[model samples]
Target: MRMLRYCSLLALVAALAACSSVPGGGPVSQTKGEYKVGNPYKVAGKVYVPKADPHYVAEGMASWYGPKFHGRKTANGETFNMNALTAAHTTLPMPSYVRVTNLENGRNLILKVNDRGPFVGDRLIDVSRRSAQLLGFEKQGVTRVRVEAVPGPNARPATVFARNTPAPATSPVEQKKAPIVVASARPAPVFTPEPAKKDEVVVQPLEAEPDSPATASENIYVQIGAFSDKLRAKMVADDIRHVGQTLLELVDINGQKLYRVRIGPLPSKARADETLGRALAWGHNTARIVLD
Candidate 1:
C-alpha cells in the first residue's frame, strides 16, 4: 500500500509540471483592450497629456514602422503587428480609434491607436506598415495627413448652443437691389529691390503677366520656414534650395511681418505631397502645405 501511494504522488507532480510549462517557456503577456486615460508622459523632454475623450484633430507628416518592431509589446500591452491596421499617437488615449486622412491622395481609413511613438521631428502619428499601405504612402515613407478621433459608443454628445431667433421676412419690393457703381483703375505699383547685407541671399519673385479670368485658380505652396528677419529666411532657403525651386514671400500675420520660404506653386495635390515627402527626408520636418 505504501509503494502504490508513492507512485500516485509522483504521477500527480508530473501532471502539475506539464500544466505549468508553456510552449516556449515564455510567459504570455495579457493584452489590455480597454480604454485607459494615462497620466502625462514625457518623451524627448516633451510632455504629452492623454485625453480621456476623443476630441483631437491635427494635420502633419506621418511615418510608419515595420518588421524591426514586430511582435514587441505596445504602449497598451498588446503585441505589435506590422500587418495590423494600428497606429501610435503621442497624446490620444491608448486603445482608441482615429480616422486618418491622407491629404495628398484623399485616401482615408480608420486605425486603432494602440501605441506611442514617432518621437522624431513634428511627426503627428506613426502607423503600422499595413496602415501605411492602405493610406497609399508606403513607398514614399512619409506623407501629410489629417488625424481626427472617432468617438466610441459610450462617448457623450458634443454640446450644441441654441440658435438665435430669425429676423422677420420682408416683401420682395422692400428688398430692392441697390444701383451698381463703376470703379476707377489705379496705377501699377513700382517694384524696388531691397538692399542686401553681407552673406545674405536675396531671392527675387518670379515675374508673370496678369492672369486671365479663365486661368484663375488658387496657387498652393509648401512653406518650409518663416522668420521675422529676411536674412534668416534667406539662409534657410539657401540650405533647402536643392529640393526644388525656392521662393520668398513677405507675409503679414497678426500684425507681425514675416519672410516665408516656400517650395512651389505645385500643379496638383499629388505632386505637392511627393515634394513634401522629399522635404521631410531632407530634414525640413516641419514643412507644410499652404494654399494661397
Candidate 2:
C-alpha cells in the first residue's frame, strides 16, 4: 500500500508539471507556439519627433517579437528578454511607458518602450510576446491596436476641464474608410547581413600580436547628405563643420552632385568615436560614422 501511494503521488506531480505556461514552464507556451515574430517600424521619408506630447493616439496595426532577439541588448541598453512585458516604439523618449489596447477585444496591457521601431506605414505600436499574449493576440501574432501614451509622474501635470461633449456619430464617411491591416507576425533578422556570392573569396588573416600597440588606420568618412544640387549640399555642410574641428568634403557620386560631411581625419577610430558621440549626445542623429 505504501509503494502504491508513492507511485500515485509521483504521477500527480508529473501531470502538474506537464500543464505549466511559459515555454518550458507550462504547456501553454508549447501549445501556443514560440515567439519569433518581428515588428518592424516602417517610416516614409523623414519624421519630425516632438519633444513631449501628453496625448497621442494612432489607429494602426500592432505586432510582436520574440525568441530570436531574446538576449540581445536594445538601443536603450535594456536586455531584449521577450518573455518580459515590454515594447518598442519609433520615438517616445527612451524608457517611456505606454498602454496598448486591442481594439477588437478591448484587452489592455502596459509596457515600457525601451527601443525604437515598427517602420511599417502608420503602424503605431510594437509589442513583445508576453505583452502580445496578455493583450489576447498570441495566436494571431498581430492585431489591430489603439496605442495611447500613458502619462508618467514627470510628465506635465494639469487639471481636467469640461468641454462640449460631442455625441458619438456613425457617418457614411467614417464607415467608408478601409480598416487597417496587420501584417504576418514573425521574428526579424537582426544580426544577418547580405549573403556573399559563391565566387567570393574568404580571407583568414593571422591575429594581430597582442603585445604590439595598435596602429592608426584610415579615417572613417560618413556622408550626411547626398544631394543633386551642389549649393543645397553646402548649406548642411556649413551647419556641422564648427561642431567638431571637422572638415567637409564634396564628392560627386554617379553623375549626381554629392556633398559628404566628414567628422575626421582624426588620430584614430577612438578619437573619431569620441567626436561622433559628442555630436549625437548634443542631439545630432543625422551624424553617422561613415566607413569606407
Candidate 3:
C-alpha cells in the first residue's frame, strides 16, 4: 500500500509537468503471482476485510497504474503486467475474475484481480494500463465504473450460476422477519459458502474481451435500496436519507415499477462513499453507488 501511494504521487507529478523521468520515482518492481486471501487490513484509515465474497459488487471511480510500477509484485505474488487485462482491488481475493463496466463510454471487460489497490479515497478497482485502454478510460485518468465478481475457473454450478450484482442481498434472517420488501424479480436465496469446501480458492487465465461498447452512462447515483413496494422503499428513504438529493425514484424494469431510494448526483466518489456507508448502517446492505 505504501508503494502504491508513492507511485501515485509520482504519476501525478509526471502528468502535471510532462517530465519523462522524475528523480526518486518509484522503482519498477517484480510480480508475485501467488493466490492469496489476506487478513483484514487498513489503508488510509479504512478497514478492508479481504474475503472470498462471491456476491461482492461495487461502483465508484477507477484509476489505472502503469509505467512506474509496471513490473512490481502484486498482492498474490503475480508479476504485475501493465499490459495485461489485470486489476488491483481492495477486498476481492487475489486472482479472481470480475466484470468491470466503464460508465463513461459503456465499455466493459472481464479483468483478473491479482493485487490490492488504487487505495485512493473510495476509488474502486485499480485497472492496469491495458485494462483502462480496453475499457476506454486510459486517457481520462479516472472514470466511474461498476465492478462485480465473477466465477473463477473450476467453479461449481452454484457459483457459476449465482445471481449478479443488481440483485439485493437478503439473508435468511431477514427473509423470515420480512422487515424489508424486495423486488419482484427476487434473486435466488443468498449464496452461503458450503461448509465442506470453505477453504477452496481457485483461479484461471482470462481471455481477452472483444472491443464492444454500449451506450455511455452519466452522473453518479447512490442507490440505497430497491423494492416493488413504494411504501417500503419510502420507509428506507426516510430512514437514512440525509445527504445529497435523497429521493424515491420509480424505475420500470420488465413491466414492473420498482421504487428505488437513491441519493445523487453525488459530487465525487468520497461523497458517494459517505452516502453508501450511511445507508449500510441503516441496514441497507445492498446499497451501491452507481454511474448511470
Candidate 4:
C-alpha cells in the first residue's frame, strides 16, 4: 500500500508540474528558437551570407534529414525535430517560412526554415523527414523543387497537392511565376579583364561550341540549368563555363526538346562538391549533380 501510494503521488506531482509550466497544456518547444540573420560563413569552399529577403526564391533539388539529425541543435537555437515541418537552407534567414513545391510531383507545402545546411552539393534545401513525407518525395529521397518565401513566420500549412506535377521542360519555364529574388549569392564576373577580387572568382564563358554530349556515360556532370529554348541553354553554357568543363546539349523528352547546360566529367565527388559550391555561390540556383 505504501509503494502504491508513492507511485500515485509521483504521477500527481508530474501532472502538476506540467500544468504549472504550460498552463492548460499549451504547446511549447523544449528549446525555443528565434529569428536570426546570421553572418557570412564558408563551408566546403563556398561562402554563404544569411539575410532577410522577402523575395527569396529558387529552383533546385530538395533533400531530407531524419534519424541522423533528429534531436540536434538547429541554427536558430531550437531543438531539431525530424517529425516537424521544418527545413534547412543555405542563405535564408533562420525561422523564416517558404513554400516548397516539388516540380516533379506538384507537391506544394509551406514549411518553416529553422536551420542552416544542405552543404552537400547544389541542393537548395534540407527538409525534415515529415516534410518530405507530406511533400510526397520521401520514398524517392530527392526531388526538384521550387521554393519561394512566404510572409508571416507563424504561417500555417495550406493547399497541399503532390500528384499534379508538370513535365520537366515546362517546369523550368514555370519559374517565371514571379515574386522571386535570388539569394544574396550574386553571379560571378565571367568576362572581366580586371583581376579576380579577394572574395570573388571570375568564371570564363564558353568560347567554343560544345558538341552533343554523351548523357548515358558513367561520368558525372553538374547540370546548370534546363531550358525549353535552345538559345537560352547555349547562353547559360556560355555564361557560366568557368564553373568547369561546360557542355551544352539538346535531347528529346517525350517529343519535347530540352537544352541542358552542364559542367562535366569531374575527377571526383570532392571536386564535384567544390564545383557545386562555386556554382551556388555564383548564383546558379538550379545546379545539381547527375550521372552522365
Candidate 5:
C-alpha cells in the first residue's frame, strides 16, 4: 500500500509538469495593468476614446502585423504573439472580444483585441498574422472586413449581416483584364483646397460635369465619410458630388445608424486611382477604395 501511494504521487507531479509546458499554461495570474479602460489619446492628429462598453461594431479595411510586432508588449500589458488570435483597434477597450468577418470571402473569426495600432488612415482594425490566416486573407496584406464587439453578460446580441455569396465563375474570354494606362484627353482638374481649420468644413466647388451612366458591371468606390447623422452625411455627399457622382448608403453598425458617403462605381482601377488622387488633392484624405 505504501508503494502504490508513492507511485500515484509521482504520476500527479508528472501530469502537472506536462500541463505547465503548454502555451499559456502554468499558474494563471492576472496580467499587470490588463483590462484598463484608458483615457482618450491622440495618434496622428486624431483623438481615440477608449471605453469599456462591449457593444461596438464597424466596417473598414483590416491589415495584419507579424514579425515586427511579435513578442512585443501589447497595449494591455500582455506579450503579443502573432500566431495567437489577437487584434488591435483604435478606440475599443483593450482585452475586448470581437468577431471579425472578411467581406470578400465568407470567412469569420473571433479575436481578442489586446493592442492599439494600424493608425495610418481609416482602417478599422489590425489583426495578428494568425487571425488573418484563418480569415483567408494572409496572402493579401489588407482586405475589407466587418468587426463587431462580443457583448458581455446581460448585453444584447449583436446584429449579424448575411454572408456575401461568391460571384459566379466567368469564362476566360469574359474575364476582365487588368486596367491599362489611359491618358486623359483633357487634364483632370486639380482642386487644392486649403487645410481644414478646426470646427470648419472645407468646401471648394469644382466644375459640375454631366453625371456618368451607372454601370451594371462590378465597380469600385472610394468611401469618404461615415456619420451617425443622415443630414451630416448628405452634406458631405453634396460636397463630393461637386466633383463627380456619389452614392449614399445606410449601414447599421452595433444597432446604430451610420450614413456612408461614397464616390463612384468607377469602371476601372485606373479611373479609381485618378478619382482617389483628385479627392486627396481636394483634402478628402481619408477616402478609401471599396468594391461594389
Candidate 6:
C-alpha cells in the first residue's frame, strides 16, 4: 500500500511537469481567461504579448501594410485586408478597436487592431493600407501619429478568411473622422529619380549646386511656425514630435522669429515634398519645406 501511494504521487508530478514543459503552456480551463490564445508570440526578433485589457495610448511613427500582406493571416487569424480600416498592435486584444490621430494635421481614423506590428523602432502600431492612406501616409510612406484605444463590443470574430468576401466600406461620416485625405488608389510615388542635369548648371553665381540632389535622408527638412503664445508652440510641438527624429528649432523664416520645428535628413526634393504633404495633413500649413 505504501509503494502504490508513492507511485501515484510520482505520476502526478510527472504529469504536472509535462504540462508546464509545453511551449507557451499555461493554466488551461474549459473557459479560458483573457488572452488565453497562447503564450506571447515570437516573430523575427521580437516577442509580442497579448493582453485582455491592453489599452494603450502611445505616440510614434505610423506606417502601413500593402501587397506584402494583403491576404495573409493576421496575428488573430483574421485575413488582413490592406484596404480595411484595421491595424496591427503588439498587445491589444485580437478584436479591439482603436482611434489613430495625426496630431500634426488633426486627422483621425478608427481601426480594428486585429494584427500586430510596425516593429521598427518606437512605432506603436501599423495601420492598414487604407488606414494609412486615410491618415496621409500613402504618399509619405510614414508619419508620426497617436494611437488610443476606443471602447467597443468584442463580439466581432477575431479572424477573417479572404474568400471573395469584401468588408463594407467606411461611410463618409466615418471618413470625416480622418482629417487627412490620402489617395489609396494610387501606388506609392517613386522617390528615386535620375539627376536632372548631369553637369552642374549654375543658375546662381558660385551657388554651389548642391552636391547631387539631396537624398531622401539628407535634404528634406521641416520648419514649424510660431503661435501668438509660446505655450501654443510647445503644445503643437509636443503633438508633432512623436518620433525622436523630429527636433524643435527656433529660427526666423522671412523676418518672423518663430518657434521652428524640423525633422529629417531626408535625401531628395521629392521626399521633402512627400513629408511636407504629411505635415500639412497634420495641420501644419505654416510648416515650411527647407533643404539643409
Query: What ranking of all candidate models by lDDT puts the best one first?
Result: 4, 1, 5, 3, 6, 2
Q: Count the clashes in each prediction.
A: 0, 16, 12, 2, 0, 20
Q: Native-vs-model 4 lDDT?
A: 0.65
Local error of candidate 3 at residue 109 (angstroms): 0.6
Highest-scoring model, TM-score = 4
TM-scores, in order shown? 0.42, 0.37, 0.43, 0.45, 0.43, 0.40
lDDT of 2 at 94: 55
How high is the CA lDDT of each candidate model?
0.64, 0.50, 0.61, 0.65, 0.63, 0.54
Q: How far is 88's C-alpha from truth in model 6 (Å)?
A: 0.5
Compose the digit string of candidate 2's lDDT tens values, residues 118-219.
777666778888667556677897889876676531222111100121222553224332221212322321222233233221111211222122245434
lDDT (tens digit, per residue) of candidate 4 on 85-192? 689998887777788888886656667788998998899999999678656689999999999887743333333343542223342234332221122222322333
lDDT of candidate 2? 0.50
Best by lDDT: 4
In candidate 6 the C-alpha lDDT for residue 190 amounts to 27
Model 2: per-residue Cα lDDT at residue 190: 24
lDDT of 3 by residue, 257-283 (tens): 466666766666555544553343333
Itemize residue pairs with steric clashes in candidate 4: 215-292, 217-292
lDDT of 1 by residue, 1-292 (tens): 9999999999999998998765333223224544455788888899888775546889999999999999998887788988766899887777776777778876556667888888999999999996786568899999999887875312221211011212225522344322222122222123333544433333333223223221346666666755668677777677666556777667554444556677876676655655554454344434666555
Q: Model 1: which residue pairs collide?
A: none
Candidate 5, residues 228-271, lDDT tens digits: the string is: 66677766676566445777766544444456677776766656
Model 1 stretches with alpha carbons more than 4 Å out: 1-31, 152-292
Off by over 4 Å in 6: 1-38, 153-292
Superposed by TM-score, candidate 3 places the C-alpha of residue 238 at a distance from the truth, in angstroms, of 53
